[model samples]
Target: MLQRPPAEPGMREDEVDTPALILDLDAFEVNLDAMAARLAPTGAKLRAHAKTHKSPVIAGLQRRRGAVGQCVQKVGEAEILAWGGVDDILVSNEVVSPLKLRRLAALNALARVQVCCDAPEAVPLLEEAAAAAGHRLGVLVEIDVGAGRCGVAPGPEAVALAERIAASPHLRFGGLQAYHGGAQHRRRPEERRAAIGGAAEAVRRTLEQLRQRGLDCPIVGGAGTGTFELELETGLWTEIQAGSYVFMDADYGRNEEAPGFRQSLFVLSQVMSAPRGTGRAVLDAGHKALPTDSGLPLVWGRPGLRYVGATDEHGALAVEDAAVPALGEKMRLVPGHCDPTVDRYDWYVGVRGGRVECLWPVAARGAMA
Candidate 1:
């Protein structure tokens, strides 16, 4: 069930409800414009991943600033974006279930839908679903460019998969899905560069083989916020699937030379407990409100405050300063993982100049199917 808007328009930031998802509108718009300016020099286009923001409002904002489309990890996310009036969407991951494939095919009537596949056996099932739905769905061959997760080997094996996709009458051979998700968080710049270099080499070799078979790739999609600049320099990745650049997290901020973007998302938690002798402050947000997958959330702009631990509904903060956060005082927490943290809330309270400016729904929050 959706919750009521935590803050109404024109309300002060401190007046908003606790454990609310907050968006710094000024910083967010700056990030958006910064991303567009950064990508304008490179020939590559932005296909901002919806798996991070999960809001069609953000999608439209990105598209209006020059994003070609949006990318999602599931068919349900694709459906949500399509229904929300996003005309172009790609399920950057594989879908093997017949019901999911049918749903993806049916979405082609509403928007341009695409999905990735790694095995030849998956082609026939996708084709059958598309044929039944009377729509030609787009398919991309996912190459294992050092991610070692969900892609086929890059050379001849990828070419074989592309060949199979092209042979299917109901499917269109879109391009390659060569995302190196693991490399996106390598703390060192040299490590990230090496990882993306190897990935680009594999993709280059695979593209050569596809060319030998008279196949042309329209899109070579891959790259996340941490490694997008490196991938852009390679000139191999045509479409950047970066999402976190819009709302950075503590994990991405840990990179040696972090992506050029400010932190725009935060969990506005209020101090519910202030134990003077123990030097501890308890917040209303914890594991349930903010995800700790990447690391503990950071106390934004609070130098002496440290988020030490968390429970289901409470987060314990260690106070190193003499001035402890009083009860009813709001604190901004930069989440460790922005993606899952965004999934916990249904509405985003857009704040500008310390006042609520608007509210946007997290339309695809739990669209994990």
Candidate 2:
């Protein structure tokens, strides 16, 4: 169980506890709206990925903002979201183990659940689990769209797998999962566009083959904050599974055509040391508080200050300006990757009008099955 911080009464953003996972409510709502608006024009349904935020609180908010449902990477994540009142969820990855598949099958009693499969072998396991639970499972066939990870080849091979899934009495063919993870962070606009174009082509060909084989994909899904527009324009993907729009990160900022949104998520770190004339300041947040896979976290509002390094519990910031942040002064640091960074925290300190309004727990945090 997780302990939630009390709601801040008449909360001012500055009054929130330091080292908390702070969320700018205004920015967050704008992000949710922007994502909805963008997808609205394209007619692409949004099934925002829960693996990024990990909080069912955030998931519910997205659903309220026009997202059709939520997609989680693991069954544990799916279970948490379902319990949190998110009735529709898609496990956008493969479930290989019998134990995990059994758990997924059991979820059908309470929610609309879907899972993905990359090979024919997974179909039988899923079928057995669904039969044991006396439920039918929704299964999507993931095709490799140049990410070169966790997908079967496009065309005949993909068709064969889908046919096998459709043939299963306990399994229903959901659709195709063609996500180009590598295209999400291409810094150059042309590069990102080209990457998704290739992925879309692969998806189109696979869909054509599936059609020939009398397999109609119902919910072709996969996209991220980086290149969702390209996928939308292709008309190949029916559902867009983007999770980072609610809390944009530094890495997403690096994208050439970054989805329009402010970075609502941040690590509220307190300055622990400030050495005069050393042009350096140290904060309490490091690897433990934020993820650095996409690179170092950016110092929010401090243009002259750069986050130079991070240890387990400390982040080094180089200050080029004369004014120094005093000890105990709080600084907001934008993480490089929002998903993994969110996994590190236990609570989201909702800030409104400069004070903490509510504390939303990271309910599905560390749900790595």
Candidate 3:
């Protein structure tokens, strides 16, 4: 069930309810502008992934800043974006289910929809769906590119899959989905450089084979906020599929070289319990609110106070240099992982200049297939 707005326009940030998803409007817009400026000099265009924000409203903002399209991880997310008036969407991940493929293919009338396929066997299922829908769907060949997740090997295997997609009467070759997800979080700059360098070589080999086969791969899409600079330097990927640039998290901050975007998204929690002499306080956000899979949430803007642990419904804060937070004191928390943490909330309380400005729904919140 969707929750009511935790805050309204003109309300002070402190007056907003606890455990709400907060967006610092200024920082968010700055991040958007920064990404646009960063990519303007490069050949790549932004295909901001909807799997991050899950809001078509945010997608629209990205489009206004000159994003080419949006990419999603699930068919439901594509439906949400298409129905919400986003005209272009790519399911960067593969969809093998005939049922899901049919639904995605049917959206072609409303938008330019695409999906990835690493296996040749999945081509027939996709063809059937596109044939039934009477719409030609775009299919990208997903090469492993060092992620070791969902993709075929780069050279002949990848070209073979692309050929399979091209030969299908109902499917057109889109390009390559070569995202190195694991490389994005690598701590050191050299580590990231080396990882993306290998990925670029793999993509180069695959592209060469595609050209030799007379296949025209129009789009090469992949890059996250962490390693987008490296991908941009290559001039290989035509579409940059970065999502987290708009909402920086603690995990991204830990990278040695730093992701250039500002921290904008936060879980607005309050000190619910603070007993005298305890040297700690409990917050209203925890496992159910700020996920710790990427590491514990950071205490934003509060010096010497650390978010050390969490339970089901509570976050333990070690209070040291900073005075104990009074009960009902609202604070912003930078979640460890922005993507999953976003799914935990139904609405984003947009704040600017310490006051509420707008409330946008987490429209595609649980779009898991």
Candidate 4:
């Protein structure tokens, strides 16, 4: 069930309910504009990953700022965006399920959709779905560009898969999905640069093979917030798939010289307890509200207040030089990982200048397939 609006327009940020997903509107807009300006020169459109914000409202904001399209990891997310009027989308991941491919292929009536394929066997299944729908499906060959998660090995192996995809009358060779997800949070700038450098070289070789095979690779897609600049430098990528730039999660902020994005997404929590003599305070928001896979959320703007641990319903703060937070005191927490933390909420309490400006649903929350 959907909860009531955490705070109405004109209400103070502190007036919002505890554990609310509050967006710092000013900071959020700045991050969006900064990304638009940063990528405007490179000619690579921001295929902003919807797995992060998961809101078509946010997608519309990005579209208004010049994003070419959105990228999703699942069919459910794609359906939410397409229903919400996102015309162009890429799965950016493989969809090997027969039923899921049919559902994805069905969206062709409403939007321009594409999916990534890394194996030859997946091609025939995609072909069946497209033939059933009587529409051509755009398929991107996902090359394993350092991220060993999901992708075909770059070079002849990837080229061979592309051949299989291009041979299918129902499928169109879209491009490559070369995102280095693990490199995004690498602490050092040099480490990130080196990681993307290797990925780019791999992409370069795959493109060469595609050229030799006489395949028309319309789009070469990939690049996250950490190494988007590096991808742009190579001039090999045609689409930049950055999603976290909209919400600077704590993990990304820890990067040395993190891509000049502000901390815009925060979980508004309140101090539920603080013993008079104790050196610790407990926040109402914990594991359920914030994902700690990346690390603990940071208490925003609180110098000595550290969020040390989290349980199901409470967050433990180790107070030091900072004063113990009083009961009912509201605070903002910079999430350790923005994407999953976003999945915990039903709505975003948009706040600016200490007042609530608007409320937007987390429309695609839990859109996992």
Question: lDDT per residue, candidate 1, 284-352, as tens digits?
Answer: 999999888899999998889989998999999998864788988898999999999999999999999
Per-residue CA lDDT of model 4 for 1-369, tens digit only, reads 877778889998988998999899999999999989988988688899999999999999999999999999999999999999999999999999999999999999999999999989898999999999999999999988887899989999999999999999999999888888888888898998999999999998999889999998989899998888888898889999999999989988888988888889999999999977889999999999999999999999988999999999999999989888889999999999999999888899898889999999999999999
lDDT of 2 at 166: 92
Residue 349, model 1: Cα distance from true site in angstroms:
0.5
Q: Candidate 1 has what TM-score?
A: 0.99
Regions more than 4 Å wrong, model 1: none
Worst 10 residues of 2 by lDDT: 1-10
2 or 4, greater by TM-score? 4
| lDDT for each residue of candidate 3 in 212-320, tens digit (9 for 90 to 100) | 9999989999999999999999999999999999998999999998998899999999999988898999999998998888999999889989999999999999998
Q: Which residue runs does candidate 3 get wrong by more than 4 Å?
A: none
Clashes of 3: 0
lDDT of 2 by residue, 151-264 (tens): 999888899999999999999999998999888988998998899989988998998898888887898899888888889888878899998988999988887667788889
After superposing all C-alphas onto the true structure, candidate 2 shows an RMSD in angstroms of 1.4
lDDT against the true structure, each candidate: 0.94, 0.88, 0.94, 0.92
The TM-scores of all predictions, comma-separated, are: 0.99, 0.97, 0.99, 0.98
Query: For model 4, which pairs clash?
Result: none
| TM-score of model 3 vs. true structure | 0.99
